[model samples]
Target: MIKLTERQDKILQIVKQNGPITGQEIAVKLSLTRAALRPDLAILTMSGKLDARPRVGYFFNENYEVKRQAEKFLHQQVIDYKAHPIVVDKSTAVYDAIVQLFLEDVGTLYAVDSRGHLAGVVSRKDLLRATLGNKNLHELPVSVIMTRMPNIFTIRPDATLLEAAKKMIDNHIDSLPVVKEVEEQRNTYFLLGRITKTTITRAYLEIMER
Candidate 1:
């Protein structure tokens, strides 16, 4: 959606109320000349706020309102809204990882190498699967069961929130690691933060409230 000027917003409100209204009538309501409204009218139409007809006047496009709301978060960058990441060392025992997961109240955990670089991702299901038929979870390391790099789905700090949401939905996952690439290092990235389904939900709610 285009950035709406103050006058364009007024024009939109006017068309919404009285459309199929002509430009001349809109100008009359605003106490302005038709010539003066020409620019604003053209901007509104071009921005998809209003639709025009041959003889009838400009009509507000109601569907565009839905798109306008959607645009609120689509272009929002991830760096501004990521949450603190829950991290565990790759060598951390499965039992400890499970305890950390419960303590943090998160569905997934990021496993980082000693350099604070992301190595793998651990989920609740992964931990649970590792516990099956194994009474000695303390002896098992999370690295043994975690989804390692090259198989992990990660988002960059510069990515859009919409991209993050789409990734979660498409992968049927709950969260993603927000990473910053390590310079001069291949297949390595520093764990920066996390983005979750809850995060996106909160963002949408905030946008709606505003």
Candidate 2:
């Protein structure tokens, strides 16, 4: 939350790119006297944005800034980064589901009921396990193995990125089904999109680059 002056900002950027750098070297880069740059360096160090040592010189406080940025980015809504849902009908055969899984190249697939409402979640492991001893992949319904509603962990479009990330981590899942609860029905959730680990990684990279 610290507001840095333009010169201080430039100094921070310089230190970030090329540190541990000497004050003398930084001064030369800025074409400013060492004396002129002292105050800015002191302010940045005291504010915990930079770290200094007698022999090591100055370095950008990478951890603190990255942590702060992560905290800020976590509050961003999931809807902003949610990707289109790759879904299958609840009755879709396990073999067909496996085909869609490979064709879409996604780890998880949302299964919808005949009404097109989210009914269950199918994962690669589920399909693989199903195929282990079972010979009839053609007769197997994905719904039989899919994790059903109420047991599935889901996120709303309005939920924070942090919420989605935490849910995935806590549940040891690679993705979350983004859903909208129906007004009249309590158990039904309309699938909106998916929030995956890939989605979170992309969002983090976008924030870092900015």
In terms of lDDT, the poorest run of 10 residues in model 2 is 65-74
lDDT of 1 at 194: 96
Q: lDDT score, residue 41, model 2?
A: 95
TM-score for each candidate, following the candidate numbering? 0.72, 0.66
Q: In candidate 1, where is summed lDDT lowest over 10 consecutive residues? A: 66-75
Please give, for residues 1-210, the per-residue lDDT of candidate 1 as tens digits. 478888888988898988999998999988999999998888888888789998998988988878877776677989998999999999999999999999999999999989888999999999889999576889888899999997888999999998999999999889999998899987899999999999999988888787
- How many steric overlaps are in each model, in order? 0, 0
Q: Show the colliding residue pairs in model 1.
A: none
Q: lDDT of each structure? A: 0.90, 0.92
Tens-digit per-residue lDDT, 1-210, candidate 2: 778999999999999999999999999999999999999999999988999999889999988877777777867899988999999999999999999999999999999988889999999999999999566999899999999998999999999998899899999999999999988999799999999999989887888697
RMSD of 2: 7.2
Winning model by lDDT: 2
What is every candidate's alpha-carbon RMSD to the true fold?
3.9, 7.2
What global local distance difference test value does model 2 have? Answer: 0.92
TM-score of model number 1:
0.72
